[model samples]
Target: MGEVLSIKSILGQEEPEHMNDSMSEVDDDSRPPEKCPHCGKALKYKKFAIGHFTFGSHLEKCDCSGAEAEREREMREKERLQQEEEARKRMKRIEELFRQSRLGLRFREKTFENYKIMPHNKKAFQTTLEYARNFAKYKEKGEGIFITGDYGTGKTHLAAAITNYLLGKYTPVIMGNVTKLLGNIKRTYDDSQYTETEILKELYTVDLLVIDDLGKEKPTAWVEEKLYTVINERYENYRPIVVTSNLELEEIEQRLENCGGAIVSRIIEMCMGVKIKGPDFRKQKLEKGRDV
Candidate 1:
């Protein structure tokens, strides 16, 4: 019927008169100099307040104890970190459930399919293509390829093969150079559209993400963090990331310490470090009398 008050509050109010000395120092004109009613003194200058149900007062002057504030800050920070991480993971969850159609542009995007599926490599390549075609099948199964070799080799061919393969699985893959992706991510960082947290989420949140040629990007802090963030996050989450590199992991690590050790370590863990051993396919293809 009236403004209901809790019993603890009722008791605290009943006792504020005796317990809160600063309240007693109040009058119509000169109040207690913005000081704590519980303690007889004002806090330094800035006053922090929080709701304490057991305590009756809605607001009180707090001394802003460094230790207490730090503890409270740490607790709040922990909560903030947890919430951020959940939101990050939620981004991935949404991505996981997502079934994006391969657009005509993406679906029809030309690949090595233009090249005749030859015999010596045709069976192996076809098998690899089959694996890519079954994206949902193999991605969930974590079976993908490194798809590498020298320039003009079938690297792009197989990379594109897998990308197109996964396209129908409702989880389309994206293709780009190592350097440009790093640039775009760095731009996002500068533009603030994708916050660090968001970038971290998106890096690994997709169906399949590819970063071709690992060591080719320009060295920079933002690039390193973004590369590390995406790769490291994907590795940790066990997301499928297909990387084609002329340089191996040791070389990648040596060149891009900007990516950070933790991130590099995770990348190493997920990637089996496959080296496509052969002469440059371009050179092989070009030679006239090159015998088998």
Candidate 2:
């Protein structure tokens, strides 16, 4: 009886071991298991498992929390690239427009980087820079600058520097020699390609007009009329004009004679005259050349 009881106990243990093996097989068959591609962790969930595809399903179907974060990161990168491309296109457009402007054509090299600022003219330089910094206010007020000084005192340099600075703000500047402007207008009578009206329109409409050697132009009835016309139009429109000259304010009046008062009046009304005093740099260069 003892031997039979021991045999029954051994059979009972073998049956339990067989049942445990069958349960393991059932669990494996219930779901296809695979490892996560990103983390290498075992995944029983079908959505998060590798080698599985779901049609028209959102990334949220994945069990890993990083799936949503990665999607967001990719979207942000795509947006950043798009914004960069837009900015590049905008900059190119701006360059093209500036290149076509009169200033870009006439004074291509008269930029701030090439301007020579002398120690004696520091205050004038600072004032010009400040004017550029506050250009919007000045433009709205129809205010401008009148640079009066001896020859070669860097008046042109400062004026060109202002234009160069203003270009960054997208303002168009036109610089012309007083004599040359009048000459071109006169030439228009014979030349069919350009008209006086068109030339004057550009002078009047530009954001900034810089007249170089203002008082040096030949004083005549025709020249005076044209000059006054240009100045008056700008005055009426409340546009800014920058003037560089070697004559004093009173001297300009004396030179203009009859139209002198009107022209000087407009100049004074529209601009603040800042006098620059310095040794003639040209004379200095000549003297140095002689010594050499």
Candidate 3:
């Protein structure tokens, strides 16, 4: 063999004539070493290999203050992506809940923001707003609200507002007119796609159940049985309910007499009573439209 040169000399200087054919070009030491863009420190060199063959050499990472900052930036970006993914999942879940809720288009616009506040509905409005605001605490305790008033007293509006508020917070809430809800369940008797038990289960397990126009539905034995079952199940499970009715507590008991007052009694125990008294908003609006 010719004079065997040290590895450092071969890399730092020029290669010998004998080794020029086998060895690739070494890094030029005359040129300045590549510096880290972030920290301006000279980058250390690292040789990459595969088995026994040395493939090449490249700059290794620098342990400068800027490196820590880059790591922190990457961590923050990861956290932001995680939060966005969680938000997307939550929105999808809320959409599914809305699909199952049976909330109609008529009530979709009935949010707290749009509810016309008047002297008659002011107390009920304030009460329902507070209930919705502290819904988390009340949900844990299974507390709810029972709203009673004459027709067009904003009873259903307030109920729908509560539904909207909770739904916006990603809480699973179901609200439907009492007549339509019972009608849907009754129709399930003929349709095998859904059973009465399945329908009632949704109502029982939802975070909050809003029953609108409660006394509007005709009281049959079947209706009373279903109503009692839903109420009793939710009551026993410590699930809250929001009821909007034109009847008072006593009237509701009388209206749903087939359940022997059990429905109204449980509702009384589960909810805080809010009675709204006012002129008919719908009638006033109609009159205004006619005048216009």
Candidate 4:
């Protein structure tokens, strides 16, 4: 019933046909029309077909010796336990990724129509998506999304959807809130045991980073330097950094008053900005008497 479990169920049902289907498929007359292999009762061909396909031809319902049945039962249980353990390990890894990271949100499915592009910057929004799709097609690479929108717009939702899709596809990704992220780095800097260099190494080296709520944190000299280092490092390394901000680019620059013009220029160069405009999405939903 949960989003992730639902997604897993959906994806499991769509598994690729990697098996040799022709070899696995039984011939019309391939079934042995004899007594059950264990107890020697009359055989059922339909049941035989299913049993052979799953448990192998040796697993005749009742015709096999009791010893054989017991052995098969043990093997099946062992296989089931092994599979469950593997699934548990994978879930643990995902949970750890979510825990140590600053941001995490994912949706199983998304589309432009589902997002409903905002009205204030409608033309630019449409064009930006088109460009993004085109870039994705040709380069087969993820692009940074520098989203500008008022609070309650669907900016974060849309970004989350993209990150979710990429993660499900097995691509490397990191998501976290902006303020928490800055606070983490700053605190780590203050702690002599946990060096900023060590932490920054992982943050800068990640494949994709979504810094949600970009301008929410109050900037300090250290925060500004670290931010600049990250942007510059990611840009040079060609790793994408997506930033969602309630404040516009101009306002962001104003806040970083002494950070120098070049750093701002570099941030702009690395990012592909798109401004979003409309009634606050939450307000609109409320006005419509709709549950968010």
lDDT of 3 at 38: 90
Query: Any residue pairs clashing in model 3, and if so which?
Result: none
Worst 10 residues of 4 by lDDT: 47-56
What candidate 2 gets wrong by more than 4 Å, as runs, is 1-108
Best by TM-score: 3
Per-residue accuracy of model 4 over 1-292 as CA lDDT, tens digit each:
2533443464564324452222232433456566654566765443222222332344234545774777789999999888667656654554443455533334335444466754575665565456444444412343476888899876776666556555544445566675666565667646644566655765676556778776677777766777777777887777777777888877888787656354567658766777777778778778889653
Q: Which stretches of candidate 3 lie over 4 Å from their true place?
A: 1-101
Model 2 agreement with the true structure over 157-180: per-residue lDDT tens digits? 788878878866656666667776
How accurate locally, in lDDT, is each candidate? 0.56, 0.72, 0.78, 0.61
Error of 4 at 43 (Å): 40
Q: All candidates: CA RMSD in angstroms?
A: 17.2, 19.7, 11.3, 15.4
| Models ranked on TM-score | 3, 2, 4, 1
Error of 4 at 168 (Å): 1.3
lDDT of 3 at 10: 45
Ranked by lDDT, the better of candidates 3 and 4 is: 3
Residues 90-152 of candidate 1: C-alpha lDDT, one tens digit per residue: 544544432232222543464546644554456546656666666666567554455545565
Candidate 1 vs candidate 2, lDDT winner: 2
